[model samples]
Target: MTEGVEQLYFHRARGLTVTGSAATAIAARDGRVLAAAAEVGAGRLVVVGGGELSALPFLGRADNARFLLNTLSWLLTGQYAPAGSELAKAVTHERCFTVRSFHPEEDLAKVEGSHVVDARPYRSLLERIGGGILPDPYQEQAAFLLEAELRFDEMPRVIREAVTTFRHRSNDYEGLLVRGLPVDAELPGTPADPARRLDKSTWLSELWLAGFASALGFPLAYHQEKHGLLFQNVAPTPHNAANLSSESSAILLDFHTETAFHPHMPDFLMLHCLRSDHDGIAKTIMASVRMALPHVSLADRCELFLPQFRTGVDYSFGSANGVQGNGPTLPVLYGNPYDPYMTFDLDLMVGETPHAQQALEALRSAVNKVQRWVRLEPGDLLIVNNRRAVHARSEFSARFDGRDRWLQRVCLVSDPVPSAADRRGSGRVVETVFAV
Candidate 1:
């Protein structure tokens, strides 16, 4: 009975025993009557053999969603419902299922004019915060983070407001760039050793990273990654230059949501640059589902919402993190349908079915068409909404002489209650043993 619907999915469906002449078999699977319809007075009744069609998860698969909507419209109006019409899209369960409209181009344009903050006026305040010798950021993180939070009000108003707005408003742009921030005049060369990079006297850029990240949410560290350091280093290492990680320079790092396979993923990821690549061409690219959704077809969008894909754990998290194989099957897109959030890892995510595979390719092409690039400088900081965006790095030449591009990275989450069990004794670091 669904208009313009050529296919419908059925799981363990039974035959509808049609006895009356008024009953009509509109859909059938093999020789079984999967669906039937009957007209009564000014209304109609539709019987579906598959009871699971009412469930949201089942409705999103194949053409079942459209069939349900069109059937509902026909029953209410006693006429053939035209496909892609407003009448065919109405549902009686709107109260339980809700969605808001989102225009990515318009929302992105509104934030583009105010993404960068003039940091020259805040140099004195930044110097005061990072000038003193403080507790080690990694070893004594509690004390160090408290020190940064205490000075949150002293930060620039533009940045403070921007961070607050970006945190609360989910439809805003995916990335924020802060330029002219203060950094250490004489910095050590980019060290390959993760621990050796943390042995620094001055803060400056690190302070900026902490202040902004703390203002947005709680800064997090993974026990299995980077020795659980609050501020992890992102620089090319000779051993990992050909690998698929932030330390790789020989290969293009594919786009991914930070820690997509983890249960308690970060809400925000901040990258503060301390140095630039030798050629200054290694660009960081980011793409949002909001920007790419407009380019995708309705059929592909429906397929993407189904739980037909799996994401693998990053090698950086190590293989002993309790997660095995491809972790769990999950949908690439979730949350509000119009303004949704997505988790995608180009190198680690795979579609489980043929339809999902085609949809995944559609998403990949859309993201590639709308991707934006940013070349970070020595005094620049890029804060990304990790849930709404996926980020990647371009391939660049790296010299082993310790002058390669260096960036300090940190993650934040709006709410920590969901991950409370994973954290050890109220610490910022999440224990890898309990991560699944």
Candidate 2:
């Protein structure tokens, strides 16, 4: 295992060098020498093999897998074995929801018979638009009209009815399945088919956007400005294919609040499963600060409120120069005093004071306490209140088969925040990674 780890490390290091960074060897007290790696100005060193990797040898296929993982974790997390290293201090979080068979017959029938819009006309309009028949102005107008129709004064009541039964009380999250939309929904015909599969005009697509924004108290304008609906067919694309079969065993998606690095992060992030990996093992993991706060020490929680922390811009979108700076570090817990908002990313967040470090550790522990696991199946939608939760995905084997997992993602920004002009430059789509 160690030998395999060493080879993989060297291979990744070579790739990093090509991208303008290099990895060097650091001599340590024991025979184990650390590998010092840096890209641009960011630097990290890996301890090679330790606790988490100890079990790798018994698995037998690789010698260096553990070492490589430890090194990568150090780079991505800025700490080795963050959760595993401090088990006692690890906060206990929970997955308060479960996947039950969503009875399409019962659920769909209920929605169709409810006050929800029939959605047939909307689907027809979308199919026309997606087939490249609708012009840009017409498409935009259609979206506006659809939104207006769905926004009757009593619309909220209907939305409440749609999801009331599925609301999970243990956590501040809920979901519902509204299937049976016209299957031929597609995008408008434009000379430039940016999202080739279909334009954002499909009836089900618009319904999702409308329903999600309504649930979060965000207006359609806010949804269009601060968030975007993205659809990706991961089947044949080289990048996506690689993402499925990538050798990280686990893709180390460091824990992060969706868009926390931005001044206007989405209040909610919704992912609806359209397909599932054949083995059904791709688990989305989430840890809530709300659930973990009780486990933190009083002193640490207080210290964590200081404004001495900073998060890196590694995952943010901005100009080359703008991307170099760090995000403002206020307390991870702030606002309503009793029920504070949380901002965290273990890899990017940095504490400048000893108190901050202690507080961060305590917060980290609290976060680990309520670890929740969600496995998405077709027609399942996971709605995370980004302001209240941090999420990650457990790595799953992606064999590049047609059955690889696929999801449609949508984000929503709630009320009170100003519109796009108040937050971003013109001609951009809500702080997307490429918008800046």
Best candidate (score: lDDT): 1
Give the alpha-carbon lDDT of every model.
Answer: 0.76, 0.46
**Every candidate's CA RMSD:** 7.5, 19.5
TM-score of each: 0.77, 0.53
Q: Please identify model 2 stretches exceeding 4 Å from their true place.
A: 1-159, 162-206, 219-250, 314-325, 422-428, 431-436
> The CA-based lDDT of model 2 is what?
0.46
The lDDT of model 1 is 0.76
Give the alpha carbon lDDT tens digit for every residue of 104-212 in model 1.
3422323445555666677887666567676666667678778877776777677788778777874334888777688887798897775444566677766778888
Tens-digit lDDT track for model 2 on 1-436? 1222323222112211112235454322234443434443566543332232222111111233344444556678665444332331222121112223222231222333321223343544434433433223224644543453454223334434554432323243222333323332343332121123444443443344444545555532222321332332222233432231211223545567765666666666666655666677776667666566655654455555667777655331332322322666667777653456678876567778876777777677656655555676654556666776787666666555444565555566665345465435542144434343
Backbone clashes under 3 angstroms, per model: 0, 27
Backbone clashes in model 1, listed as residue pairs: none
